[model samples]
Target: MASGDEPSGELASSLRAIGARYQELSQFPTVTHAALGAGHATSAGGQTFPLYTECSQPDLARRRRLRFSRHYSVHRSPGSAVSVSRAALSAEIHHQLLGQLSPTGQHRAVLTRCPGLGHELLEVWGSTGRSCSVDLTALGKHGEVYKEGPFACLTWSHAEKQLLYVAEKSQPRPQPLFSWDAPGAARPAEEEEEEKGEQFLYHEDWGEALSTCSMPVLCVLDIEESSVTVLEGVPEDVSPGQALWSPDDSGVVFVGWWHAPFRLGLSACSNRRSGIFYLDLSNGRCELLSAEHRAACSPRLSPDGRRLLYLEGAVGGPHRQCLQLRMITWHTRLTATVLDVVQEPTDAFAGIYTDALPPQCWAADSRRALLSTPQRSRTDLLLVDTEAATVMNLTAGLPEGCWVLLTTQWDLLVATCSAPHQPPSLVVGVLPPAGQELTLHWVRAEDAPPVPGVSWKTLTVQVPCGEQSPPPCGTRAFEAVLLSPPAGAALHPLVVCPHGGPHSVFDARWRPTTAALCQLGFAVLMVNYRGSLGFGQAGIDSLLSRVGEQDVTDTQLAAERALESEPLDRRRVALLGGSHGAFIALHLLARHPEHYQACAVRSPVTNLATLLGTSDIPDWRYAALGLPYSFERVPRAEDLAAMLLRSPIAQAPRVRAPVLLCVGARDRRVCPTQALEFYRVLRARGVPVRLLWYPEGNHALSGVETEADVFGNCARWIIRHLGQPCRAAPGQHSP
Candidate 1:
């Protein structure tokens, strides 16, 4: 039977038994979206402020999508123990709900239900009891609506009469050669030929999870007129996204990316040639607001609309980098100029390590904004004062956890904080005064129950240094999160998980899979190898052109360190990775075959040579190799040789460990061919291997059923290969 398909033999019963462990952990609530009102209300009982928040958790038992959304009203009082009042706003099954609170505190919510399916509903509701429902499926004129990525947006106009969002530009309808019209119908020859030819034309997409998104255009929906118009002023070469209505509501300001170099994947990538542009609806003219060469995005206007804030980074090289905060003084609509650099990264601060700022990030003073950014292993909230050109870390005094700023309303700041040992908890606090940190009196808006019998600690791996050998990747050390099982066995099986995006960091936060694995009696190790984010830019820059060698070494050293210090069974160690992490896992399995007993890779990159030509971001391979990349650059013999030399396939013959490959057929990032190449090699060589193909899944394998199924099979593979029982009794060791 195919992977993810039901099996008929005894293996089917084993998977079902192993998958039951994820039920409770998968249902852990997560704060999805929250909105704060403009002002508070005073009642006879006490002063109460209303805050709207949405909580979602995966319904893994269901055969449909994994998560369901629940809306709540959180009420708080000043100078007293804050209590949250749970009032269910609605019980609708909405895939996404974007809530916008008007300046007058009138709530406006736009719900998109059954997204990505042929039938979709766009429902809008106002606090005054007025609502509108638009059948996006029946319209059939526009493409799928964007709900994620850099282009995703849903914002209300200043006057609250219209809604603005981003969606794929409509394509020309192609009809069959023999139409079902009247048998004797006469049609123009030119029109018939055009329709027939267009049916076969190929169009490129944004790739990976956003495969359906291409040709993003600004769309405006006028509620009063019940009309939707696609704005046409944007240049065809520029893909506009993250649109916002101008201060006066006369035009739309958005980020425009040039299509010349080919639209590289924009998922976790930040360094793309893009600029902030303003499109005037009256004259159908779009003007670039930021410099043409700067990679800029996330434009936020102040409350008074006097200044704009954004983040900018270098144009090329590593897809993700430390961003510099910038500001623009909007003296008037006629003219706006680059004001000054708000904050440049220093050795102490590590720059702005986030893609975008939260909505309503501005403080009550309007001179500062609250930003959540990663620093090493923890995510911290930063207070950026534009006037003083200073950045302060606000979470320095808070409890140990990853603190993320969700949204801000006036002087109130809302965030979700969590640690490896703790579940995510939504907390709201009043912004503390300058120079003073926030007191620990934050009111808990909502909290998720922690998983039982799971414990964790952060580990620092010191890179081995010899007199003759310098530190690999220009760093002497990195960190890892080790989740230990309950203290039953002296040594438990270990599963080393390295995250994707060599640039991405695995923060010390509660993750569903990590927690579930621990509950299943495996000590999980998440390594933040060199070049991972949160570390200084120097760390990120050190990994350039050294993809295979240094990254592989760093992961091995980290795992070795965890094994040495923790109660982990070095003999029963297994490997788990995705994307770039998978590349490293494969390299480790081949180079140091004895260190790992089994391996599981999801959407792995086995050969860079094959992926460079088929991936959405071909520049990734070149950049990883420290070579120049452009749309016009053709792969030469030497370049191909270098890619092959660094690939895991070059050393696949040395791999003796049983491997499990989880591939997404729709993945455009690493390409399914890369995984298939390794599978074919292992199979031909008589090596033990298995492949699970998710036909409808993307690079993330994010489908509700796909994720649960993949995790269950992965756990089963590791357990069986490591000589452990399929279902170990709680607080007991499996012989």
Candidate 2:
């Protein structure tokens, strides 16, 4: 190993190799968005239609990502149960951002962000070869267009004359501390006063990735009139978004998130208190359409426009939980009826676990909707009958992997499917008639180049049952996906990976890190321990209050079981994780020092007590410890002690493995100080440790260049430590 902070020659070589491998993987573009065209035709071979998909891939040369739409003639094969030929690319549209097709399909609305110029451009392109552009920043000083969260939306009116979207509410222009207006430039004293105090006033945003989204409001654009209007009647406390024009265009339906108690981290959190509401344009009245107290979003209207479908989960609980499908009947202009489509799961189905539904999810029948949700270790596309309250797994016949529903138009459905060892490939399927088993014959719309030398399988690890053992109420059995090179080779080094979210599940989908490591002859074990989602709410609730003990034990047991079962070198095992996963990884390293040769973590939760006051999701710290959170609740001595006791910092003294800490300096979810504290402890103890700080990276460290650097360095770190034998210190013992 190198004597100082700089990487060794071997480490540099491995980093370059890993970077090149990742760049190779980036060549396969994944389908990001799909839009079906107006015409639908049936061919004798099977079926054919015009499909438009927005594909994205990392442009390594430019150090950025490139997104473009491809038009294709998708043809399905009749001989196969459900399969499509790799459709030839018919046409390509480049430099389009957030394109929304009009109802009549004769026009398209495009919203593009020009960060370099510090503004946004909205363009409307008509089929007749005419297009108009509007500089949103200049139009009315409406804030940047929302690109994420429940507030992110771009929809067209049925008449195609208007467009509805969400944007941040304009803020008062800042004024000098002491300035006098010219004699001719007289301004109202009240308006001038409003700008004075706003210069440095504190304003809370939606949290993390949504830093600029402090106050979101619905906005409508009149194409012909060249005007933009911020819809009224929305309560000041409510942040309205996901707005869509109502059936007759008399009103707009939207989801409103209340900013009362406070805004917790909204990224990947689905249980924020919100509801579906309708804003009447004529009366300027906003009426709550769904249960006001329940958490709801993704208000999708049916094909016939008489029904409204949305998802609801319990409020003030887990950050993410199983959602209950619901449909509301628009009986009259004044009244509506609510129906519980899938309130709970049946024997075969687990529950609905999805952040959002596709924009074009409804089928031609107006009752069935296509949704992809986590089911165990894989994501399955399900055909949901809103009226019948029945669910069918549409992708059950596919290989054990993830099948994500992208969009649907008429009877046509588009999705991207992939396995742990495969890259994402676009597939198209036509919905079958109602009351029939949905054996969707999926046709490959776009093919991803096959990844060589990688193979994977799912392994089930049953939680040990005993009186002294932790309660097995939620997770009786968990699973892990192990990816490795082809068989008949030397036993490979193993990397035990635990996922963050403790509530989030690790799907058996293609990941660049896993692929790169597997290709480099390292077997990667991705453990979806007890607390992971897709197993059920019981499994998630089971780990509460038992974070360190239960999660640590579960991961250790899963790793040990894999070591015993698979052809992996027991002595050459390392740990890799992020956030909560990193917390578990550190615990495993500290408690079972002899088992792991090294450890690499990203923005780990080292000391929960210290993080409670710093993290954006302080509520998560409380919820993980089987406690509820409130802004008014003060942390007592015992609470802080309990938090530290369950955190990895308490066990840091026992950790002997060489460690690599990757942290984003700007991370708000888990502060960078958490990694620093751990690094200091390990360095003080004379443990070989290195910390890589990304100045501009956030909690996820998900930037294209940042991720490449992280993964490449992580590979180098693991390789260096795994090449040598790891021995525990004189006093340490495996748990």
Candidate 3:
């Protein structure tokens, strides 16, 4: 087949023969439709897991009836049995299928199915917790409820029985505003130029009275009355975090962080702080309860409505560096007292401070409470005896994990544990009599794809640095699943796949794209470099300013180690990544062009200055890059230049490898302008580069057509640049 060409019948037959040979030699398992069901039902000594899906005639019929897998399945019982209601069918399917799959009875159901909103549906978990659908499409456009799904929070008024929803509606071309409403409300007229001007005039005159100055307002919908009202207004400069309704639905609490302003002719603001505000729904009055707290976050109300439990500060920093479980008494006018503080001096940063604080739920008596301890490197489940002021650790051995506690009459907890290279599994257990120790019971283990013809091992090596102790580097080593071809595949190509999230570690999850690469004949090496989370704060801190230097060294070292056991074509190695991974790819091409034949980068950060200025997230640029918030308070130009030198765009001309840059036009996280500017510079410098822009995508390429284009183009690019024929020809598809 020619480059980018689809095979004809004759070519297909030839390719099939080649595929068959590899299939035989590699022992690639034939994955049939029947085999697609649950594999290897192993019990951890528990009741037979509730089966979520059954091999039934209805399932078969539904499968055959639908042309696509996205369609919903309809089941009919034999012998003309009474027809089940749609709700009953959904409940039965989830109960029988998911209940069997997961012993904890924890499953999510997507009820609303809107295609334009990309199957926008409510995701209902358990029987209570209701979260709105936050899918990009749903959050971006305003329209009818497109999909049917479970809701995180659904409340029907005891009086009105009307349903209120926290929803998004598209305004103009670029803005999405969160609004409060009930079903079947009349739509507001689109704001026109004349109307906008008049509104602005009115806003300038009575903005404060009407709460129009607020960027986003907290709203409450009285379902029975079909009335919507703004409960509170978010301050202009502060970024809102989470909002929660009071148990009685008479009040709302929201958390937000405000950036400290830079003083003229002085250093930039050094402190980052947040506050919790309580809004009275009856009167639209807002008051700050903990206005003095710095960096306090994740406030949860106690069961009795007498106290609040929250995390104070960033948890482990120069600031309040302790994870203190605080209690606030409403009787004391919302005064807070620190109850128990979790901190370790040996920890580079107090570990508990960085952990996320989940919701606090009460035990049956409402005296004992269960709350997730802030996750250290590993998560620890904690049972707090409120009256006794004592804390007990549960699930101590599980490292780098998360847990959910269901405080039903019987206290049941489900925990998921995982490490750098271990696939995660769900474990269920019950709290002991005294709520001290946990009685462990295995529930279900995640089924990881068996690695064919490969054995995997892990190794830690010391990377030497001049006059200093070499940084400890860890990697998981695995043999290639596909064997070399008869020509012995002597010059087998290698791929250096760096994961996104400079701080996110790589784990042993089943990634379809990664497996596809292996099936297409490539040896892939994924690296979890320094600054990755779950390894402790020191590891994460190491990558703060030294992003490219050490990470690149580790990547190169990993490649060298991989080459020791296999014959690799040094000249044919390529670097591929997305998001922050894309940043590393660009950095590699710029700093070590000769090391890679080509590079593919998606949604990469090109210019640090532009990134800081235009990123959707406020204060992230300053915090992540260790930069001052405002330019006026920044250091001298020389110092700024030194910092900017580390940016990818600055070193673009030094990139000798062919480049493929992909970006999403609607990506708010990493603006498309970054890619556009980088491509512009590369072309100006006469570098061989291809730029692909997806107008409909955001940070992720999700649509089927977009994903096909990305993968197909990437494969074709690799083959063309490496002097190999492509399976899909140019005219066959558009990249």
Candidate 4:
């Protein structure tokens, strides 16, 4: 405790050892030979310092008895034998201690970070006269007032002084006391800051979690002043999103919520019911603008501000799932009319559907709205005329093997065309006046990768409509995109790769993974099974409660159709899928074990009962299990039992195919445990199974490295197991 003593660490450890021995010897007063206790030295000065304060009896009682170390030779009557060594800090020093302590290459930061595009904040990416330029003034500097993550409800005041956007609730909130780099006064550690407990939600449905009815706090960032202010008037229980300023700039309108009372697990719910609400920024009074009878989303005011355009769909489903476009007279009074409702999936471009929901845009004239609609197999750019009650397919001629993602200028269309044969390329186009068959004239704004040396075709399979035998789902036709190997002399092995989402679509866009499989000499059948988009809402609704039965039959019918139609090798058919598609693959194998030679699935949903408790989307179980879920609370035990009855595991006993389960350790949607549990059961039942767990992956396993591993390993697994007769796990083989 001397003023010049800076406290030696080696001396400290040696002193603690001696004191521990003294405490142990004190337990037995009868045996006392040496005066055992600690002595501290002033480092390498060779001078020992006496203990400054009386050691607490409690401290001595709790300290463990000292033992001889393997590293040191403990001699009787030893003076300090502890060695002083400098601590290793750098990563290189740690590497010298072990073999796998270094990275393969240096970590690089983004030198040219893509300054994302937005309308309310800045008008940058395009121009009228010369070459397009970007305004990077606001890049990388928004953190002064705003935190990270996607910004919702982006808008600017008519005067352009203030900007508004909704941000997520930042957790653990950086602290100075826990930080060693900075100095600060003292404060108690937050429970949230504890190691390895709660992590920030980074799931796909995080938007619902972070900005729900009870949360979605609108933030006003002052551009000139560099300050943030939380906007009031948004009701605490009514979560607001997709906000925009009114014509007079006196009010804010947004998609508003008043759904379930609780907030837990809202992120992955079907989240359908909502209505438009307006907040008068003047007096901070909020009022509902649209009726709550049906769900609606993407509320947008026209450029002339005369009318509003929005999407309406079934309640307790996606607000735009039905894909009906509606318009409301805004200025005079609020009167709503359906501009487009999906009555049929025929000639009319009545309902909209896309790979994911595309952004709705207003034409410069403000009468017609431009958007994308998913027709049976391909997604087409469509123009909806609200006043005329007619919809026109603007980019219908984009072709079957190609898909165009549209972005619009005030008048021209800026798009990126992605085809199975080539990489995506940016192009500019026009709608061509007066409809002499409006062709999307491409102006080649950016280059594309050379066209692939392969052939592609589309197949329309007549699938049964009913989940039940009498055909509750009827015999309806669905499409599949077939990618053929480069040189097809002999018949190729058929790979049935069904698209997932149960509500999603596989567009005719360039997918390297699928192309890679085809390049490896497999004829990949990318089946758009029942319950997929592009087909109307009826087709999707058909497979809802009948997840296992309908989708399974559809795949079988599709594969049969493929054999009848394409030059596919009958004995070499395999199944490949992920998520819901994986669910289909596993269930198909369980129900009809001999249906495929082998199967590969990634992050599969094997058991609804198992997933109901752990998954982010519990409603998915009830919905898929033919039970009604209100999204308010956990499903009952009886409900779960019924769910388990329909689970793929129920029929897992019939599985005869060699199965490979691809699991993502960090998957939050379909937790990795789901795949592990499935794998264990299959192995126990003597089914041939293998697991490929990706530690750095999520529900998608979508990183470049993970994706590459998936494609390579997947191809290898299918190829290796393709012709091997049903081989159960060892020790259980039949004679």
Best by TM-score: 2
Global lDDT of model 1: 0.77
Residue pairs whose backbone atoms clash in candidate 1: none
Q: Write the per-residue lDDT of candidate 2 for residues 188-291, one digit (tens) a residue.
A: 56666656756777888877788788999888888898778988899888888888888888999999999887777788888888999998999998889888
Displacement of the residue 575 alpha carbon in candidate 2, Å: 0.4
TM-score per candidate, in order?
Answer: 0.91, 0.92, 0.61, 0.71
Ranking by lDDT: 2, 1, 4, 3
lDDT of 1 by residue, 32-83 (tens): 7777655555573434556766666676666654344444454544543355
Q: Rank the candidates by TM-score, best first.
A: 2, 1, 4, 3
**Model 4 local distance difference test score:** 0.58
Clashing pairs in 4: 213-239, 353-374, 465-473, 465-474, 465-475, 466-472, 466-473, 466-474, 467-473
* Candidate 3 lowest-lDDT run of ten: 29-38
Which ten-residue region of model 4 has the weakest summed lDDT? Answer: 94-103
Over the stretch 1-735, how does candidate 3's per-residue lDDT look in tens digits? 111246456545544433332322222111110101111222432222222221211122232211111111112122211111111132212211111111123423333445443444434344466433333243433332311111112222222222223332233442224334577776566734443333223211001111122223333344334344443455655534456655465666666555334211101111246677676767867677774655566666664566666655441122213445555565575554444343222222223333334433545354555654333333445666666766655655443334434222223343344332223333344445664355544343222233332222333334544513344333121111122211232556777777676655554333434444544555566666655443444555555555556665566666666666556677788888887788778888877777788887788877766665455432434434455444344445654464467678888889888778888887766788888898888887777788898987767765545655576566556655664422211111100
In order, the Cα lDDT scores of the candidates are: 0.77, 0.80, 0.47, 0.58
lDDT string for model 4 (58-127, tens) is: 1233333221111111111123222221122211111010010001111110112233542123221111
- Cα-based lDDT at residue 308, candidate 4: 82
Q: Considering only N, C-alpha and C atoms within 3 Å, which residue pairs clash in candidate 2?
A: 82-441, 82-442, 83-441, 83-442, 83-443, 84-442, 84-443, 84-444
